[model samples]
Target: MGSKNISITEDAYERLKAHKREGESFTDVIVRLTEDERDIMSGFGAWSGTDKGDHARKAREQLNAEFEDGR
Candidate 1:
């Protein structure tokens, strides 16, 4: 694999260092943090199968009523 040298401010460097585990490199910490974020949406697509559709419809009706009342 190829590599590049990037620079960060002291504050940014400290933040990354804080996230690094024992014996882990900055690259590892960054990859771990980013990969963790990707898993967030893994089950979000299943929302339609739950009560989310009904909840959304009810919320929309409530919002519409509030808007009509304000008019």
Candidate 2:
């Protein structure tokens, strides 16, 4: 595998460092954070099979209404 050198601001470096688990590489930390986020929206549906769909749908509707009202 090939890796490229990239530069980040000190603040950004520290943020990633803070998220790194013990014995975890910076690359692993970054990939874990980003990959989970990419599928987070789809994750809520997994709860829908357990009778949580109505609650989840109501929450979504309330959130949408609040945003529409400029809250």
Candidate 3:
């Protein structure tokens, strides 16, 4: 595998080191930190269903009414 060298300030280095576990390399910590497993498609079509669409519309209407009343 290929590697790159970058510089970090002492404070940044200390923060990364603080997250390091026993017998774990800084490379492992970096890899673990940079990996993202959040569902990218989670909200892509979340309101595609009829029920969700209706619920969202109602919520928006309620919010708008409340704001108009406050004003």
Candidate 4:
């Protein structure tokens, strides 16, 4: 594949370099950082079939009770 030259500030270069893993190219780091294109509904139902939902509900209930009690 052909590559093009682009200019970036020293600070920008340093930041990108910081994110680069050992034995990885700058192109690989750029792709890895920018390739995440998630849908809005991707996280829907993530807590389903888990006790996390119940825990959140109980926490909300406790907060509401405390608010009603003016504490």
Candidate 5:
């Protein structure tokens, strides 16, 4: 594949470098970091009908209560 040159700040380059494995190129690190990222919309309805869903619901209620209480 053809490659393109890009620039990043030193901090960003260091962060990416920290994630690079011994045998991985910068391209490999970038692809691996991003490849499994999920769209936020894909999570809609994902928790329904599951025990975790109930937990999440309870957590949301608690958070809402705390917010209402101005805590």
Candidate 6:
């Protein structure tokens, strides 16, 4: 793999470094900071229709029931 070199300001470097976790590289920090965890397509439809799917379905049903009962 090839790497690219880019220049960042002193404050930018410090901020990026502040987000660095133990055992994580600068690239990891950049990706974690830049990637949108809430993007539907990113993790959407990736469930295997097992544990998580079952729980979410149950939660939705419970929530709907609560609203229906006005509780």
Candidate 2 whole-model C-alpha lDDT, 0 to 1: 0.85
TM-score against native, each model: 0.60, 0.53, 0.60, 0.55, 0.62, 0.49
Better of 5 and 6 by lDDT: 5
Worst 10 residues of 2 by lDDT: 43-52
Write down the TM-score for model 2: 0.53
Better model by TM-score: candidate 2 vs candidate 3: 3
Predicted candidate 2 versus true structure: per-residue lDDT over 1-71, tens digit per residue: 89989999999999999999999999999889888556555666565453657777888999999999999
CA lDDT scores, all candidates in order: 0.82, 0.85, 0.85, 0.88, 0.90, 0.86
Candidate 3, residues 1-71: lDDT per residue as tens digits?
99889899999999999999999999999988888778885775465564546777888999999999995
Candidate 1 on 1-71: residue-level lDDT in tens?
A: 88889999999999999899998988989889888555665665376545556776887899999999995
The local lDDT score (0 to 100) that residue 13 gets in candidate 2 is 98
lDDT of 3 at 15: 100
Model 4: colliding residue pairs: none
**Residue runs of model 6 more than 4 Å from their true location after superposition:** 37-71
Off by over 4 Å in 3: 37-54
User: How big is the positional error of residue 56 in model 4, measured in Å on the Cα after superposition?
Assistant: 13
Question: How much does each candidate deviate from the true structure in C-alpha RMSD?
Answer: 3.5, 5.6, 3.5, 3.8, 4.0, 6.1
- Which 10 successive residues of model 5 have the least lDDT summed? 44-53
Off by more than 4 A, model 1: 36-52, 63-71
Per-residue lDDT tens digits of candidate 4, residues 16-68? Answer: 99999999999999999999978986665487654546767888999999999
Residue 64 lDDT (model 2): 100
Clashes of each: 0, 0, 0, 0, 0, 0
Per-residue lDDT tens digits for candidate 6, residues 4-61, read: 9999999999999999999999998999888876866566546677445776788899
Per-residue lDDT of model 5, residues 1-56, tens digit only: 89999999999999999999999999999999999988876675576565446877
Supply the global lDDT for candidate 1: 0.82
Q: Candidate 4 clash total? A: 0
